[model samples]
Target: MTADTTGVNATTKGADAIDEAIAKGIDFDGTPIPTAKLELYTKVMALEANRQRSGVSNTMRSRIVRIGAKHIPQAELDQLLTDAGFAPLKEKEIAFFYGGK
Candidate 1:
């Protein structure tokens, strides 16, 4: 029997609609987006858009360190990276990402 594709299409359409609303600064619940929050987000995203990139792998590693450090302990994240065949966190990265924790 052929698989039904309608569910996937519906999900995609719903996501697209939500994205369109977000771009227009309208919340899904129909409230207008707060000006202060929107302005700050736009400014930060603009800066991120202009940031320099070294390479895909370096960028990936940086993102992993930045986000993973928020949710995982330092040693656990480092071991996970090594086990996944990525380079273990460097001293500088550890200091920067986990210094306060």
Candidate 2:
């Protein structure tokens, strides 16, 4: 099993494991987290098989930015994550991917 540099699950267990990680807010390292601290680390692999189906034509970073933005409408990406019962993206995480605000 290979680890995704993006910190997303890259094991060959199955798609369900990947989905579980996403739903539970776990990183590729299988770390149990995402509560008070906000940090966005998307499972890019999940979208690997569906990138064409989703009609996304941007680069990985751009796609991640879009995911952060689309997760919540009219609300800060981190705030939405926090509200969703998962850890929200911190300032650094936001700056790194979503740009500094």
Candidate 3:
């Protein structure tokens, strides 16, 4: 997903935003991502994609790291997600989380 800059807080860094989103289960999209999906994300990431650091699993591992970084709200996550397929939530959308959603 792409980071939707339109909704990001000018004062908050992307990594911090992402961190809050993950901790609070705020969907990057305006709509709420069902908890099941969130659980699934946890489960999927737990899978042993590779045994050796030598092949396809390594690629998967890298992708997982990028995904984690995105959630980590790390500065690098934005760059990685720029090349990634999903989009981030908008600023207005994030308000719902604080609004008692």
Candidate 4:
């Protein structure tokens, strides 16, 4: 799964973007975060949001975050996803409050 310069999901193109931007130091808009970084965060947040919509458990959510954190700085990544509109909630705490499925 990948996206192109137009932000349309096209694995090779997106990978190319990552390689071009991050690996090669290409710049499109003078944005602080590279194009690849933005795309990476966007996709990760979207996936997490989809998982939430599907009712993935708190344990599962934490696992997902942990996995993501391995790829990038955890605290910054967490804030980035939260700011992008992914609901920040604890799956385990949710279970405690409302019970689990």
lDDT of 2 by residue, 53-73 (tens): 533333443444456664544
Question: Order of candidates by lDDT, top first?
Answer: 1, 2, 3, 4
What digit string (tens of lDDT, one per residue) describes model 4 on residues 9-98? 233343466645443333443234566777887788779767745445555555546555555454565575577566464565334433
Residue-wise C-alpha lDDT for candidate 3, range 2-100, written one tens digit per residue:
444444343345557865555556555544557898888767656754334566655664555545643554434444544664344334433432224
Clash counts for the predictions, in order: 0, 5, 9, 3
User: Which regions of candidate 3 are displaced past 4 Å?
Assistant: 1-20, 29-31, 48-51, 55-101
* Total clashes for model 4: 3
The TM-score-based order of candidates, best leading, equals 1, 3, 2, 4
Give me the candidate number with maximum lDDT. 1
TM-scores for all candidates? 0.56, 0.27, 0.31, 0.25
lDDT at position 85, candidate 4: 61
Of candidate 3, the 10-residue stretch with the lowest lDDT total is 92-101
What TM value does model 2 have?
0.27
Q: Any idea how many clashes model 3 has?
A: 9
Candidate 2 has its poorest 10 consecutive residues by lDDT at 54-63
**lDDT of the candidates, in the order given:** 0.76, 0.53, 0.52, 0.51
